[model samples]
Target: MKKSKISLETSFWAGQEVENPFEFLEVFFEYANLDYYKETLNHFLLHTNKLEAYEAGTPGQTFIIYTAFRSFLKACFSLKTKDKKLKVRKAPEKWSILGQASLTSEEYQNPFLVFQKAFDEKTPDEFDFFLCEITHLSLSPFAEEFEYDFITPFIHLTKMLDAAKIISERGIKKNKE
Candidate 1:
């Protein structure tokens, strides 16, 4: 069966205006699937494919799609270190994806964005910091972090995958209704 192409972008943004941003994270996670990630790793891993998929063969919708993704992310993840708690610093309608944040490709793995950033000067704390930054998912216990982890990180990771799976199932169920 042919699935309907639904751009829930406007509604997604509207939700942000009324509700706490992260409240819609579960839905965001659905769109942030294999085709949705164009930020860092997804930007590189799927750049060629994204372009090739475009019949115009130019970066047409790419920029628009990217803008929406970044705006949503910047709204949700743009944080500032204030005392101990990190607070939202910017709620930009359009995020500037200039410099290193922009995707460039010539080649590629299971490229780990966190480990790849490892350098001599950076400390282990910084490693943990970057992990939270890249995932945009905090591991801080008091940050009211989502209950992803149970016994180990593996369990948490499993739960995340399962959540994604459930989201797919729910979509199918709704479409049938």
Candidate 2:
């Protein structure tokens, strides 16, 4: 009998790559039988989600959201590059979400606009979109061994939005008290 080796490399990108960055999580759960990994990711999202209660219009909310998002993506990339040391690119302007400019005055007032657009479409928000974009660009060099299909970058926006609903629920309970 001959033995066949499976390659760790993944390809599954069509022209229209799915907009949902969290799609990988679904695939991860479906194909991989690693409960601890699943639990860890779930916990991370829950904890992060707890940090920011989404109020329609609030100052400083964008900063909090951006910081949490940056950290989350960094952690995810670290997992992907476990073997190799990950370093910030010198020129973030070139190909990194870390370089995205601060929100303008209007946006600063209502960063929720981005979230609203994404919510209406039932797709990942702009941050998730950019995260996936940067991930693809940065990992292009390693395309041969890149696990794009499974590591489909961004944490889903819907998950965060869903978590926000808990805030309103808690408020209702508090009011009843």
Candidate 3:
């Protein structure tokens, strides 16, 4: 299978170092088993040159790509975290039920907004919506735990998809040779 060579550039926020957003996204999508998203991205790459050809003559191609990419991102955001175990920490303070509820609600809402902001600014040529979705996921409260537990397996799958996109794009170029 061919892989996509679409590379994502990483950004730093608030002077703190950030992980490669692309890597985080790759893992999130893999963990969720979003095959449709993968397939659509693959299809896009397979016809990239054709699609690029249309970029100037047909404005609809842009929307088609944008909408499809957005849908792919939505799929990633909808994934539920399966792990429920709470890790123990030293000197933990007790909290009321209401406090816990507040924290959970805040966790849910903040990440979504952060993701939306990130998604809105992402350039379609460099980053996909799926990557934005993963960026949001990585910022969530339990991302560290999730990463520690599942990042390895997720990386394996993402690498396959990445390779496919790269190969497909390359194949298109080779055909012109």
Best candidate, lDDT-wise?
3
TM-score of each: 0.27, 0.21, 0.23
| Residue 152 error, candidate 1, Å | 29
Task: Determine the C-alpha RMSD for candidate 3 after optimal superposition of all C-alphas.
Answer: 20.5
Mind giving the per-residue lDDT tens digits that candidate 3 earns over 13-132?
Answer: 112222333333443344333465455444433333231332345545444444434443333222211112211121125544442221233332222332333334443322443333
Q: How well is each residue in 1-177 modelled by candidate 2, as lDDT tens digits?
A: 994422212223121222222333233233333333334334333333243332324424333333334433322332222213222212222433322223333322233332333345432334455544433333232223332332222233333332222211222111121
RMSD of each: 19.7, 21.3, 20.5
Clashing residue pairs found in predicted model 2: none
TM-score of 3: 0.23
lDDT of 2 at 125: 39
Better of 2 and 3 by lDDT: 3
Give the least accurate 10-residue stretch of model 3, judged by summed lDDT.
79-88
Q: lDDT for model 2, on a 0 to 1 scale?
A: 0.32
In Å, residue 71's CA in model 3 sits off its true spot by: 3.6
**Model 1, span 1-177: residue lDDT tens:** 995432334353334432333334445564455234433333322223232333234344444444344333332221111103322222234534331121212101111121222222343334333334323321111223234321232222222233223323332111121
Cα miss at 99, model 1 (Å)?
29
Model 2 Cα shift for residue 23 (angstroms): 25
Model 3 pairs in collision: 2-164, 3-163, 3-164, 3-165, 3-166, 4-164, 4-165, 4-166, 5-166
- Candidate 3 Cα lDDT to native: 0.33
**Which ranges of candidate 1 are over 4 A from the true structure?**
1-19, 38-60, 76-177
Better of 1 and 2 by TM-score: 1
